[model samples]
Target: MSTPILEFATDANNPCMHCGVCCTHFRISFYWAEADDAPSGWVPASLTEPLNPWLRCMKGTNGKTRRCIALTGTVGQAVRCAIYSQRPSPCREFPVYLEDGRPNPKCNELRAQVGLPPLPELPIAPANDPDGTPTEPPTEPPAAA
Candidate 1:
């Protein structure tokens, strides 16, 4: 299903506080071709060592429990994507607030840490049935805005 774009307030009043928690916890998967297309800054420690060419997941180290290799920054510092411009397709398409209308745990955690209320749910498709067929089509959120 196509992901919805969550509109964020972009004025100076809505500046990112830079807690750096999201980049530390999420797992970002990248396609092999996308990894190859990464820019110079996106090079991780794993890429420097000899390894199999067909590998998929490159686990993060040092404070970041298990995250994508491309994420960089120490805890309490400004977290940033090494390849912000040339990020992988998944990174480019990440939901700003929700993933398939479900509240992303990482995002929710960050919001709660900052004392913000939970965001409203978005439209999303239901999970598949036992036989592997989709249970239902996407539905719109309630009109109470």
Candidate 2:
């Protein structure tokens, strides 16, 4: 089965911060159609090397240690994605799991490489019914001793 689609929520308690692991550690390739949809001068044609006539991937990821051309600032210091709003679908879909949820191993590996701890499991959201009602009523915790 395919992985579940994860939602990105910025929380004060969240651990992610300019880690740049995903941007520098993986080959982010996608269909040629994606490049065409990118705004003029956003994802420059020259910066993308063709994986095939129908596919193209961003350059600068040929080696394991190479960083993406769009990455700016230091890897673990204060990095940022130059094209965050216009990043490819792959970038948008990179999971940042919650404290009780399943792990994204690749993401955790990158974190480990940078001397950061693995992300805590994501908390499972409460289930909803077909009509969007909560499957069970909310309950308060038992009284503390």
Candidate 3:
């Protein structure tokens, strides 16, 4: 039985600190417009390659190991996204914590790679879970519109 982290306090520090598994493991592709409409010094053209003419994606993600070009520092110790503020929607939307039911397998797998323990279940009341399974929540704060 894993210990549930429950809801994160507003003042709570990010649980993802020192964990960069998702940044290095995922493909991180997104629509071309994300780059097209972004302000200067945001998602730079140099860090991305065309996924297709209609899509753009992070570089360094094409190789077997699949590390994002934006990743800096060491995994499981200290790390950060170089373009976190201007990251593509997919990267921005990735889940970092488990919620009401079951845990995210990919998130778990990545956690294991970095030697972190598996996330606990949602910790919600049984009635809240129609199927009694836990879900997950987004990793970061939503970007302002």
Query: In terms of TM-score, which candidate is strongest?
Result: 3
Clash number for each model:
0, 9, 8
- Where does the lowest 10-residue lDDT sum fall in candidate 3? 136-145
**lDDT comparison, 1 vs 3, better candidate:** 3
Q: Write the per-residue lDDT of candidate 1 for residues 21-46, one digit (tens) a residue.
A: 44455555555544543453343435
Off by over 4 Å in 2: 1-15, 37-46, 98-100, 125-145
User: Each model's TM-score, in the order given?
Assistant: 0.43, 0.65, 0.67
lDDT of 3 by residue, 7-104 (tens): 44431234455467787877877777777455532567778888897887889887788888988888765666777667877775666544444566
Candidate 2 displacement at residue 102 in angstroms: 3.3
List lDDT for all candidates, in order.
0.42, 0.58, 0.63
TM-score of 2: 0.65
lDDT of 3 at 18: 49
Residue range with the least summed lDDT across 10 consecutive positions in model 2: 136-145
Q: Looking at model 1, report the run of 10 residues with the lowest lDDT sum.
A: 10-19
lDDT of 1 at 77: 30
lDDT of 2: 0.58
